[model samples]
Target: MQGNKIFIEERLNDGPGKMRCRINFRFYMLLLSAVYFTMLYIFHGNLQSETQKPDRNKLSMGVEMQNAFLKIQPPIDIKRKVLASHQEFVEITASRLHVQQVFTTSGAKRNDIEVENSIISTKRTSQMIQKTSECFLPAVTPNRTFQTIEPTFYVYSAYLDRRYNDRFVRIMALLSLNKGNRQLKVSCSFRNSSGSIVETTANFYELCENHGRMYGGFILSCPIPNSDVCHVNVSLQIKPVHRNYVVPETVQVRLPVTQLGWQEFPDQTSGQHENHGQHATFDMPYNFSICVPPLFGDIDVMRFVEFLELNRILGFQHFIFYVSTIKNPDMYKILDHYKKMGIVTIIEWALPSNIRSGQIWYNGQLSAHNDCLYRAMSLTQYLAIIDLDEFIVPHNGEITLTNLIPKLFDDKVCGLSFNSAFYDKKFSKSTSTSRLLTARHTGRSAIFSKVRTKVLIKPSKIFEVGIHHISKPAAEDFKVDKVDTSVAYLHHYRDCVPNYGMKCKDFVEDNTLLNTTSQLEDNISSVLKLVFKERKKQE
Candidate 1:
């Protein structure tokens, strides 16, 4: 102890002694730290490279480029297109009500009848829905829904959605207002931003169901929009009202609708066959004379076929196909095919040679006939002048032309015209037996008038009326037999791709009516054979 004390005293007594001790202690500590750090560093480096695995979400230095080339893209809507918004209304009508004879044939009874225990009978047998019980429908003009055209309006409240996460929600108080102009009472309580009851900056708000009924307008708390309009929450309410005043369970007798959807949809189309009186032989009542009109031109042949088919389906016993301007070979091919099908009677179009010279429109047999339509009445009973592309195939096959068009004899229907369409492109999307047809929706040009054929002509009828050539479909003809899309349709040859045009020229060259408007005119000019220069390189 004495020796240690003496050594400590000596270190405190002199500067050289203390400085030497301090240096030795510092060297030893540095040496120890270097050894410990080297060992720790080696172990940590080994642990990280061996145990740490790759992560899937980690961005790597490389990515695949081939995936970008294989992605599929969306196609453009080709059938029909409209910019912005499209609104459509479909009203269920009495015609939509399909009624079958539970115990009798269709002609045996009429529409509007009550059921009897022994046998079911009908009184007024149209497709209009019969009122069974008082319905909840509001009183409006034209009680029939098919013709209901009351004015209605709706109001959309403005709101701002402030929340970033919420997209939409359902509210129990939302009222679907049907009747207009009577809303007067409502109540709700709500609070707003800035700790106030109705401040604009409030986030939590509520409607007091009573006070906010009509004009107060339900305020919605919404988030500020970073880009788009921020929609907020809203509520509505209406008092409960009793129902049961009108009829229920309206039956609809629907005819198949099968027209190819065109740019203009044909909603008011006829689908039923004619219904003539039952007081005739074979139980048939009407006679129809059908033919292709020379005015219908070469392009209207398909409409003729459809009209004739419909006439027969509606019980037209007698048919006359009046052949007028004559037809090209292609038109004849279509006619001949229908003829071989054991279809119905047909009369070819014929013109008196002298009158033919005078332009049939000016001097034909019915030129002065009944102000444009009924003049041909003397030549036939009921007439269904149709184009070739149209076919009136009935679903039930019970009604025929005579049964469907008794009014044709009435001279009321002046003229009825069906519709045809044209696709903007030069082809059809149809893959049926009519594939590769020039008359497809992607049809060819109708400019070429080869051998003009005219066969369909109706003398005049109150039901069979005027030209639908260049206008939208009319509403009056909704009762006519509606052609089905499948078994029966107007196979519009005008929509054809103009298949074999050069081939047609050869066949029609000798025929009358079309006298080569332009004969094989090639406008391409070839001077000194310079056009062939580009092809020389491949050789």
Candidate 2:
């Protein structure tokens, strides 16, 4: 013990000895850590290189470039234009509901065709929530078409205040001014039902592209007592930005409650709007007419042939198509054949040479759709606005639309809306068909993922037409009904990618997964059988 104590004392006396021992231990620990980390780093680097080499071919350069481009680009700021600070009522003339053709010196095209008996006239009464009447003429016509008196700067609004039963009014109008002329004073005045002039100024704001095709507008919002305004006058009291004009045009348009979307209206007439009782030869020939907008893009002709045959089997009597300037020749050849048979009516939508491409309010198709609706009102009891790829499938066992609709629909219903179900090309199933052409086209899927909506309505009730929904507001008596998917819905086939092949990736093994009798496959089969038999006879 005494010798150990002496050794300890010696160690304590040597201060550098203990310090050196501690320094050696720390150096050893650091060296071990460095070696461990180096080994891990080398292992990770080699593994990563091996994994990346295999993935290099799969990586998309185009996608990377697109992402980078999107990341660098600035976003467009959009705001809705406010047109009024106070509210006023305007009474729309029922007889003068027709669109007025405006003549422009620059554009060579003239809109001489007048769509008559489109407006349903009714006596103005205090209790009338929705009165069927004609409405606004589009300001932006085709380059060659006659220009209407309405300002080229167009405005429309659809707003409902949940707090009160009444809807808050908003107006969006576009102002056509010289380039760089940003600021201008605008006024809106209308004669109210109480025989007083209600006038207010509009505050304009530019909106974003997300608002869809309608151009940004100068908006007006204000609160007014519930009264009708007979006329609305919008004027720009500013000088030209560049051109020398006699005066800035004061754009005038009649104010109809229906135009303001204050009430719900029928989408089709009950054949009451025409003088049908007088003509003995005018037998009720058709039950329902399907009105489709002009065809765009290079659509497959076989698919369209399938569409017509199937619809006929489903009991749709008449068809109307607006033929745009560019259409597939094969598709048109078939359409021409149908037109000769008097089953199809083709309206040429001669777009102005100056109009920019893409979907917008200025697209002549809006007018075309409305025209078809009015024209078909007297021709058929019901009219449906649908797309080429859309199929209105009934959930009930009833075979035809006429049989199914009567059981589910009534006169009180302004529109029978069917939710849209999206069928992707990835899940298409193959059908066992001996014919090569039939086999090639029989792969569309019956199953779907998402549901958008399309409407079937009476023409007399529709005040305004929209892409998906009616623009007119709903009243107590008239409103849009969302039919249960179990009753019926639209099968909207969409492309998985741009021009994706018709074949589906995931084939549904169970043929009965759709659980409905109106399976598109079955419909297609029935139509093809009839068509093939007819062709054989002709040959």
Candidate 3:
């Protein structure tokens, strides 16, 4: 949290100065017609083996088989060109960031800059701000801020990696100011600290392209430079942003923690249990489906509700609840919003546990399409079957979830397999008994891996599905689909939230659910709390 704070501060300082000095980008977008033509180019010789033209839903059919790792094809037209030529190399991630200045109006300008006649090259960094909304039309503005007529332009795109999203950004542009005084248009050149002439002309361009987790950036200066206002300094502190639909927990806020593991992972040795993981994602609009056993109580109900509410920002949909207890009134209210939205579905288990297990395993086999045997018996179609708290998102992508998803679907892949990113109950200012219950929300520590949530499969493909508990017998290791999940992810809030100790205390006393071990008790009492007062202030 502290590290993120510093990053935000730096971006704030420098963002404004370089705001107007960005490159006028020229993007080469491929129209559907162009894509169609390209497809024809690849499959021309094989047309004899085919019957019809390309399908309308090409994006949804089978892009995954195409192999994106292949080298890019050559441009169709030799006359076409990249608008601003990017610098080929840089010394470090830091060297690539520099500044170009454009004053609203001035006797002063940035062109008159000079370093050294010999200095010709160095590295550069840049940002591209996408103008989302316009301000001139007017709602409210400070009195001193007057409406003025200026040519209106919008930022179509911004290319920047999350790695540098909200961090301290500083730029030192060499400005060579020419002295003829009065009103004059001046041309200039820039040089490095070493005195070599780096550039000449004034058309300065800035580039910020965030292509998934891996990013690309460049600065191209063309028109001219002058030495008088030769050096322009610009910077900003960009705040870290999670582009995924699923949001992570932060220590910055209080949260209700459910204590289960007596010891946190990575801190213990002998009996250490692998953490659910801190790298999984929960992007918004991701579906969460679970088959709950009967006999769940209020604690389960409330935690799930809280988790859903917090993730509404990321967009959530499609919940399946297999009620363990038919009389769970609290559980019904837990999904009031979803129920209102007509997106929740409920199923009851009519058979005993043993029968249900058998049914589940049978369903799994049939749905996966492994044998010719189970094919006749399969019943359900599940795009994906996932734990309620496990959400999924892309590990990397340039577009937000809304756009990223289409790109994935364009790949025509089914089913995403992801591991659990865990959080545990720790002291937050929240109590279940408080008038307004609250707790510190601690989500992901960091994300170093990705997971898949949306899958293409029939429901029966997996017979019995739930969080992958390590207790089950060994099964074949199947790899999860790998997609750019920058915004598509899962977050297991229920696993971490809820003061399980108190709930367990009351629960064990009443003899419901699993037996709470002494170890569980020790961990809960010592670690969990209902710190609602602090929470109220925060939320």
Candidate with top lDDT is 2
Highest TM-score model number: 2
lDDT of each: 0.28, 0.47, 0.26
TM-score of every model versus the real structure: 0.23, 0.46, 0.27
The list of candidate 2 runs beyond 4 A from truth reads 1-285, 359-367, 434-451, 473-476, 496-539
- Candidate 1: regions farther than 4 A off: 1-289, 294-318, 325-382, 392-417, 422-427, 433-491, 495-539
Q: Which is the better candidate, 1 or 2, if ranked by lDDT?
A: 2
Candidate 2: tens digits of C-alpha lDDT, residues 270-344 = 343232112211222345778888677788766786566556546565688877755565565566455534456
For residues 130-169, could you state the per-residue lDDT of candidate 1 as single tens digits? 2211111111111111110111111122211111133111
Error of 1 at 347 (Å): 5.3
- The true-versus-predicted C-alpha distance at residue 291 of model 3, in Å, is 6.8
- TM-score ranking of the models: 2, 3, 1
Give the higher-TM-score candidate: 1 or 2: 2
**Which of candidates 1 and 3 reaches a greater lDDT?**
1
